[model samples]
Target: MKIKNLALAVAALYAGSAYALEPFVIKEIRVEGVQRTEPGTVFNYLPVKVGDRLDDDKAAASVKALYATGFFKDVRLEAEDGVLIVAVDERPTIFQININGSKDFDKDQLKKALKDNGLAESLIFDRALLDQATQELKRQYYAKGKYSVDIKATVTPLERNRVAINFDISEGAVATISQINIVGNQAFKEGELLDLFSQTTGGWFSWITKDDQYSKQKLSADLEALRSFYLNRGYLEFNVDSTVVSISPDKKKIYITVNLSEGKRYTVTDIKVGGELLVPEDEVRKLIRIKEGDVFSRELVNESTQSISDRLGNDGYAFANVNAVPELDRDKQTVAFTFFIDPGRRVYVRNINITGNTKTRDEVVRREMRQIEGGWYNASKIRRSKERVDLLGYFEDVNVETPQVPDSPDQVDVNVSVKEKPTGNVMAGIGYARGTGISFQASISQSNIFGSGKYLALGLNTSKSSKLYSISYSDPYYTPDGVSRGFDLYYRKVDPTQLSLGQYNTAGVGSSMRVGLPISEFDTVNFSLGIDRSEITLLTGAPQNYIDFVSAFGSRYTTLPATASWVRDGRDSALYPTRGALRRVESLVALPGGDLRYYTLSAQNQWFYPLSKTFTFMLNAEAGYANGYGGRPLPFFKNLYAGGIGSVRGYGTGTLGLKDSNGDALGGNRKVVANAELLFPIPGLKGDKSARLSVFGDAGSVWGSGDKMSFGDLRYSAGFGLTWVSPVGPLKFSVAKPFNPKDNDKVERFQFQLGTLF
Candidate 1:
């Protein structure tokens, strides 16, 4: 009787065994209705196996386990002839996903979004995921201010139990901020406060700035901006209580209302220093910008703390902490500030870790670093190191981080990570101009070849008037002291008669070797010497002066030329300089060995002053003088010419110089050019360097040997120019009105070039 009870208890322990079924020992198990899933997979999920005793409990458990796998839509089990048969209907797989009418987002991006939301191709189809994907797409568009977006998802059954999903979308118009109001009373006027916000109601410039568009992100930023504005002006207790946003019934107009409290303005009553002043008290006092009796400013306080911290960091205190603890007296509307400084352990750099230079040589990058390993950590050196690496042009981005060494309080590691960019360019272009017709140019240049940081360039250009071929090579780090070496070879042919410039043509071949010495962080002095050989050919209608010059010096001659130049560039960016200055002073002389013994001196200075984040004022001036030496006249071809787009924009190319008897421009030995411009960002595209618009005024001219240099002789013009860094190349177009022009001057009201300017 006890053995019988044990058997019955074991059966009772089996779950869901109340529905009685005959017990049987399974000899084999067969899976059915599993076309996609393998038989073994069904068996793995099955609770009962071959040679196992089966009953109603086991059968129910097997069906539950198979259903939990979610791979099957229907599951069943049957016992026949002592063999267990498992059945399952596999869910349909997603074969393809199609999205149409998606102009704002890329198709791949949409697909990826769906995949991240648990819906994509080649996955089990779920009707819930289709709705989820639709919502996700709508949410993305809504963030961009598109509130009326409509999405229709369709699931089409395919062969082999697969399904295809297609999302037909109708993205609607952006919801514009029709009105914005500040509900709470404020010390500042509404107009003044609105100016600080990134969002705004409709205005003349709204189309360009898109500030009228309502976005949650922009609203949050505006709130933060409002908070900062008040805090910067002594509103110590300013708070943004609430922000209310609403959209019209049509989903095209949005209104924003911000409620805020304007607290009492505070004035600085006293300033003091405390806590481990490693430097002299007087020195620390000098760093504080806030003063007693002045309006309290959080920005000023932050600056004072940062200044103190940096001062300590200069002395190897890499972990220095500086904080401005303020005490407020609401009754008197006064605040007192105490700058507390903590000069942590004087740490040194234990290791210099460099990464992300997968293709570039490590030594190539290490050479540009100014911060040294195993040395006292100097913040200035670390900053300079980052700047040096950033200016290499080999990397798209450079980042430096100094992290403390593990388990070492006085040791740190300087990590320099770089993102390499393609340093080579292969460009081929065809251009047209009235002066130079049907021009073709091709160039292959690499600034970092084979990751060696060597420079090489080969170029070929031909026009109706001339043909040029050149090759140049340079090693920027030829010596440890930051000296650069380079060589250039070029062959050229000119037929000025082709463009009616002159009835003479000359072909030349020249080679030069140059060395650049870095005198300072932002300055370099370069010296080069070259030899040139040219043969002049006087055409049938050659000018008398040209014939006379050829007769005097002979047709064929060789000259050794030497040049020296000092360059200083302090601009914030090379491509789009908004602040700082660029200055170059160059002198070139044809030595005694040259057929033409002459010397030329030139100076150019360009100053870019930033007026605002998106506007700049630029001033440029250039002057050059050339004269004969050793009783040999300066070669006519070497004479300076000014005009056209790069000089006086309204005048024709090379037309600002003296005119010969044949009505062709005769370049002179002296030149002067000046330009003033108001530069600003392209509408709707702030901070985009690829394109810019500028209004400019220009004045320049050239003087012959017999003519005297005078400002009165300079050509003057004013115009607007557009510069676009297009895929093919940089394109510059300008339309100018000449302020003053002589009747003989060729007036080119519009000019454009599809290549780099310099």
Candidate 2:
């Protein structure tokens, strides 16, 4: 009976085995519904593999791992006869993207924006991303003050689980700010506070500048400007309480109000410096702009800190930090400032990195850097390096950053990033003028040739009065010291009989070799040697002077000339100078071997001074004198001529020179011209220097041999001129009336040029 009980107990122990699960080993892993993904990719992401025991936990984890790859939207796992199966539904791939009805923004811009928002071509499509992209496009247009912009997105499925997304955008009318109100102000009037803002209410100039448009960036800038205005005027504790902006129901009008609390004005009681004085204390004190007993000015305090930091930077402390701590005494309304300075370790440049130059050679860019590698980090040198690169005109943008090297406290890497511009230009143009007739021109020029810092130009021009064929080559860095060498060869034919000038023609061939030497930061000295051969031919009704010159010296002559010139340019910009001066002096002499021996001296100077925020005063003067030497007369063809766009704008080309017996202009040997202009941005296009309007007054003249070059002999005109750097090229237009003209002067009131002046 006991043995029977033992057997029953054993049976009872085995009875629970029926409910227990047996471990099933996976024999193989199978991936289904994968159209583009590789089978190995699925296996790599699967948590449960072949020969592994499958369980609920492992199955769940494998499903999660597959979903986490972002390649599948739905995943299912099943076990059939110990073989694990992973079934997935993949998200559709983007086949094509189209954007329509977008005018204010570029199509590429929108595509890039969508790509940045995770909705690019060939990327797995997500419904949430499509919705986000639609809203993002709307936000972009709204930031430009297009409040009524509407954006719609459509997703159409293709055959092989692919989708085509189309974004249709409707950019509505721009929203303008109708009024800007400044409230809670006592010291300054509303008008005064509003005047300080670049953003204004609607005005006559709103259409061009669009300053009245509401933008978050502009609003933030205006707020900072408001703060600076109050802080600079001795308001020590001024606080901007609140700002309220409201738009009308139609989204066309905007109103803004800023509330502020004006604190008591404070005056400076004393100022002192506190820091590790690596330099003498007195030298640091001299750098401070704020003095005791002056009105507390935040600008001066900031200037003082910058001055201290710059002084330290100049002394090799590139990472210096200077701060101004002000202590205010409420009882006396007094403020005292202490400038704290920390001069960090003197850093050196460890490496120089150049980027974003896909076409230019690395050495070509490195040669322009002023901050040498393995040298002390000088901020001024770094800044000059960027400036030098910008002056190359090979790049549209140039930026430099000095990032400290990791694990090296006193070492930094200077990185230069540049956006390259088109270095070569091919131009073909046809121009017309009353004085010169119709002309056809074509030119090919490249400033950077095959990424080398070399220049080449080929040109051909055909005109009723002149025809030219020329070629030139230049190497800016002929030597390491920044010397430039170049050569020019040209053939030209001038037929004055086709125009209203003298009835004579001349054909010539010339070649010249030139060198430029950099003398200082803003100065250069150039020397050139040239040889020329010309033959003159007389047509019907040729001028007597030309007939006399050809009769005296024969029809053909060969000459050699040498020239030396000095130029100093301190202008802030080369293309559009706003404030600075340019001076050039040159002397040219024909050698004794030439048919004509003559010397010419010429000087040109232009100065620009900013009179206000918008207006600039410019003064330009030019003088030239040429005379014969070694008992030979100056070549008549080489005589100076004045008038036209480059001289007196209202007069015809070369019309202000000496007169001949046939009431035609005769070239002269002496010339003087003076011009004064009030330059300012166009009324609506304020701050756009690329397009400008100038009110100018010009006076100039030409004088023959033995004729005096005097101010009284100069012609005068007053006019306005427009200049634009357009998509095609630089354009200039002028309209003027001569102030005082002789009866014989040819008046050309309106003139314009397409390519270059004169």
Candidate 3:
């Protein structure tokens, strides 16, 4: 073995020295042994041509440049009869590269990523490139829990100037959290300290959330959270000293240690106000809720300063500023706060400027603004205009700026800029239910019509059991003063599941007028009035069980109904709601001249709570009751039915209400529902805005007879769903399982919809 190795080493040395030769002048330049490389490429790198002179210095420079091209290994220049000849041997690259250890990033995707970074099959790989690739791979691994990883690249040369590369990766065991220790904490227990951090020890879902991954970024954020927690509770001098992370010898477990300094708590000694005040000092002081004898809370101090500023703002001092400075006495454990106020000259808006709205018209933005030019500065109105602009989903970013007029100290100009996004969508999809049975729908709509920020939608659906066509329109700034208005018209044909009964076709046209008024910065009240006339065609399949109820309660042919509704919307956004409450109270009454005369009253309340940065919980409840007073009974078109995306998830569409003997929905009079969800991003799919995934639990039921409402009949469903914001708008897919099932219930394990949310 020693003799063979020595012979190989000597051959390598000879090959290296064969290219080192004295330079000679050239009469002609010729390239030998060229295949993939162009002849011009060799001539471009040659130091001597047919008419040029050659020397050792130029030859050495030429060799360096040729080698830097990374395409050749042995480059030699020879001269004979004053003719220059260049001979070269190319380096073989790994024609195929295969990786073996990856669970977080898909193999195909990782290969593509590597190719983008200049690591590809059949390419000449160097030590520098390999080192960079290894570091990048480790970064991706650390993003998960595999903190310790090993990678080995094995290259095997193949025939025809090629090689095959195989990367054997040993993805070390995932590191799990063994324990978390917090020192120098007295006001809170150890359990409380652990609860403050998102990371935790091993749990049932730790593999999914992966909270065990210890990163410097996460630790820094946790330390800031601890600081805020203590500051809000009057620990004015609290500080975090240091943090230590320890890993086990086996590299499968980790421990965290946090060192904190809990200084003395302080009480309020005195409060003082300085600087100019647009409002009376005594009146501004009343807005500060913090008392002298109370504990010194950082939150309260900030709140008090903000309250004072708001009070001044409402009084026309739009540029008022307030800052709180605290003086601490270590001996007495007391802190004194001083609030400095600055109220700039009261300025009126000189001009309202609009920009950044590429598609939306200037009129649309102007109409939504509450602050008007040549009017006294109103901070509340300016804030309202910003909110109104944000509510228009056409923009991804909306901001307002107040630039002072050059010559006018008392006048300022307002500028509103918006970023536009795609607002048109097309939807072509199908759905199935016991009653609808393989229904297909096609819809098209433009939420920002003609760049005017108006909504217009048209939809059509056809199925074996029914057909529907509808057109709807909405104007958020209907009156040029931020009031909202909308209207809808539809014609639908409903055929019961039991063909032996009958079918009903209904045609209606409706128009509604709405007005919106802001009750506060984050709340608004909307009132609407609408009237519609419907013509009902009773066909042959209306179940025998529902015939009696329909004949007694529903109208015979045509009916006219009038409705009035009051709604309050306090949500942050319509598409991705984080925090809000929606309350609606509506009443529909049959006209005296219509075929049916009756009244129905309904009220619903929905509340959304943000559990964390990535999770939200929603609760909703509704009730409706109808009684015959005059004329005929209520029409079937106005009856309420529950199920599907906006109701219970485990059942078919409109199947939550009372059912006839043949299992056809008879509609309902009362309904109630509650839902909870935990939302997070999908692992390895970060930065993708097309879809959002969540886990949810649903519970609710509907009752026809008010007195029969019972918890025993309540249905329960738990599932996970994926919401995709596709070009055709939002599409939702859910796989749900029933927690409790009844004998006659049709519990669907999977349900999906095109555009709806409950």
TM-score of each model, paired residue for residue = 0.83, 0.85, 0.64
Relative to the true structure, candidate 3 reaches a TM of 0.64
lDDT for residue 468 in candidate 3, whole number 0-100: 75
Compute the lDDT of residue 723 as modeled in candidate 1: 86
lDDT (C-alpha) at residue 384 in model 1 = 82
Weakest 10 consecutive residues of candidate 1 by summed lDDT: 1-10
Query: Between candidates 2 and 3, which one is better according to lDDT?
Result: 2
CA lDDT for candidate 2:
0.85
Ranking by lDDT: 1, 2, 3
> Which lDDT tens digits does candidate 2 get at residues 373-471?
889888888887898899988999999999899999999999999999999999888766557777888899999999998999999988878989999
The C-alpha stretches of model 2 lying farther than 4 A from their native spots are: 1-43, 50-115, 119-127, 149-174, 185-212, 229-239, 261-271, 279-304, 329-336, 495-503, 538-548, 708-710
Clashing pairs in 3: 94-122, 95-122, 95-163, 501-541, 501-542, 502-540, 502-541, 502-542, 503-541
lDDT tens digits by residue: candidate 1, 90-195: 8999999999999889999999999999898888888887788889999888877889888999989999999988899898888998888997755888888987
* lDDT per residue as tens, model 3, 1-758: 00111111223333544334444556677777676677898788755567766654555656666777877867765566776666777777767888897766788876776776677876776656766776777777766667778778777877887777777778887888898899999999988877778777756656666777776687788888888788877789999998899989887888999999978888988989899876788997898878798887777888898888777766667778898888889999999988899887787898999988777889878877888888988877888888887777788888899888898888889989788888998878766444445668788999999898889989888776667787888877676545667776766665544321225555555555555665555555665555555555665656553466566656344445666667788877666776888888887776666566667888888788888665677777766766445745444545566665656777666666566565556665666766766655554333355666878787776676444989987888888877777764467777888788676566677877654311
lDDT of 3: 0.72
Q: Of 1 and 2, which scores higher on TM-score?
A: 2
Best by TM-score: 2
Candidate 1, which segments miss by more than 4 Å at Cα? 1-107, 124-131, 152-173, 182-212, 229-238, 262-271, 281-304, 328-336, 495-503, 538-547, 662-667, 703-711
